[model samples]
Target: MDTHITGRTAADIADSVRSLLERGVLEPGDALPPVRTLADRLGVNRNTAVAAYRQLTQAGIAVSRGRAGTRIVDRAPVPQEGFAAGSVLRDVGTGNPDAALIPDPSRALADVVGRPVLYGEPVIDRELEQWALEWLGADLAPRDIRVTVTSGAVDAVERLLAQALTRDDAVALENPCFLSAIHTVRLGGYRAVPVPVDEQGMTPAGLRAALDDGVRAVVCTPRAQNPTGASLTAERAAELRAVLADHPYVLVIEDDHFSMLSHAPAQSLIGAHHRRWALVRSVSKFLGPDMCLAVTATDPYTADRLAMRLSPGTTWVSHLLQRLAFSLITDPEVREGITRAGAHYAERNDSFAARLRAYGLPCTPGDGLNVWLALPAPARAVAEQLMRRGWLPRTGEEFAVDGLPGSAHLRLTVHELDDTDAERLAADIAEAVRAVSRSGSGMIDR
Candidate 1:
């Protein structure tokens, strides 16, 4: 392992350490040499070794003991799936929408121009905004509709929080919340109040609790919430609205990421009543992946405040891509494509969940792009076993909110599993639970 520690910089040192652990040269609890001695031996500054140590710590490949040196930590294995295109049965994780939902853009971009716009180019194309306005609907008018585009729903969330919050401010969010929303709040240096979300969107009790806590802002997903896919019901929405009515001026941000492709209609926290709110809807779901554009409708006053952070010199969204999105959404053929894709995703996910139930593995299959599964053991260990069987499953740990205990469940994207493979995965998951379900592993507490 020392033979590979030849470079004189921080990254080189980190790579050498990583390579050692990867090759099993340093097993768990084996201490690295003293920083000064390692620095001298590698012929580099002490800072380089320090930086390398930090990198390993972040990656969970190693841990430090202050004055003591570093040692390796156990890591779960990573699986390798083949890189094949045009297969809908291989995509997993929170961030991906169903591939079938993506608009076929080969024809749209085929004839489109390729010039990247220069400075002073319009931040938003006038024609595109007009089309987007119609797309969002006419009921959202009379109050104010300000359309601002961003990379995606997550991008819009970050910018909205940045403008509304100072570091360490409190923000309300859904519990077992979408990971991007949780991460965005934490990254902005804000404390998160996890309001519970049930069949009814944010519960009335949860809303009241959060408001009583004096949160600076609220991030909500009123429709087709990512992990659970439970769209807020009308009765629940009304109760939540009543709870929020007292704090009319708090910045209310709603992320309805499944804009056009959702099987159900959109619900809103920023609907007709609110005075200070933003309804952020992104096109990444129906449009092709990597297409980054979002339409934000806000109350006029809030729109002006948000605009201050979105002026020409700073963070305005792109214009050319906006036009391309406009061209696709307005076209009739692309609209049908989205409808077809939504049905396909629902059918596939429902089938997988039904099969899981048939196999005695209880789970929930709801409206979004994925399935939520409740396992009999810790999700992390089960996911590791799934990988060894050629399935790459994501655990719910990353998306758990502050108040919630880490789950024994996993959020599986059934889009990646075909009929045959779904059956096999279900069987493998059952075996994995039996193999790793050690009673005192702290899995229950986790």
Candidate 2:
């Protein structure tokens, strides 16, 4: 059946499709008529229909499959990491740091109290700003960098993108991108150009292709990339820097979200000669998610634009939150706790991967809070079986982009699991993989 969208302009046509989607008339995977066909039916220029489809694609509501027509998006390109609602199964997909591992902010609360921050004051806490400048500056190549504070990594990313790009501007993102970055690019009406990532982080060939495609900005996770836990090697970082040198004006944003907690050293993307770049670090993984604080160090031009939105008395992050994070990060005891927590996460994930390998499912333990387990069967099938066995696992499909095939990998978090729990879960996962292999397509209910 042909999808009927009654409108001429791009906005009108996009709105019609959006309404049909909301009403469930345009179901996921349902194909739209060819652009030319739609233009003829609507008695408008073919370019108008094309423009409308482009809008839908940018908004992450529809996808163009080249020879195949455009279709409504089945679900978000990247799903959030956490327990699914109404699920009673033990969750191994929530990308959460162990609560016990997070340093208690209450102990730091007393230290955070001081003079109340008045109106028109500097947006960032002075002490925090100075600390961040020193911390971020030490790693960056010689450059005139300025610092800006935002609510968290997500906030920093959103502000950076807004400052650097406009509607439909192409931005290169890692293929298995972070969910928030996917959401930010989609909601901002910007085009996301996917660059493939591997064990060594963003590949040189993929990044070169994206640069050739005229992407205005690039968002990279330098270490402990979400879902995949890939980190850039020194060699790969050099290659990427070389490729980016020709495109000096392109804004490169590195999200070092796992900084203190990451076992990997920072392999930076911003070379000394690159014209525009930002490095954002957040305390969410170490201090606590509730801390809601991140510091962004960037080139002066980007900082000026970011400051427009972060001006005092308007969108500035609360100094109280900033102080709390600063205190937690600086306390010697809290620092030790964070260091131990980091080691604990790495060890737990490594142990889980080793167990899975011994069970005949070879997997790698990456630096992030989770382990990516590769199964012999499709991850969704294995995940469904795991759910039946009272474990909820997140399939890699949620993190893939660009019409890429669903991965046989599962992103699992085991930082909070005990020895017994880890062993049991590994055994169940192996069984689930075997079951899926035996049953094939019949095992999973659509």
Q: Which candidate is the best by TM-score?
A: 2
* Residue 156, candidate 2: alpha-carbon lDDT: 92
Candidate 1 colliding pairs: none
lDDT of 2 by residue, 1-446 (tens): 34468897989999999998888888887888899999999999999999999998877788777898888876545566556778788988899889888776777778778898787677788898899999999989988989999889999999899888877789999988887888888777677999999999999899999999999999999999988999998999999999999999999999999999888988898999998999999988888788888899999989999998666435788888888888878889988888898899899999998999889887887889889776667788888889899998888877875546657778898889999999999999999888877887643332
TM-score of each: 0.75, 0.87
Cα lDDT, all candidates: 0.73, 0.86
**How well does candidate 1 match the true structure in TM-score terms?**
0.75
Question: What's every prediction's RMSD, in angstroms?
Answer: 8.9, 4.0
* Model 1 lDDT-worst window of ten: 75-84
Which residue segments of model 1 deviate by more than 4 Å?
1-95, 98-101, 110-122, 138-142, 312-315, 403-405, 436-446
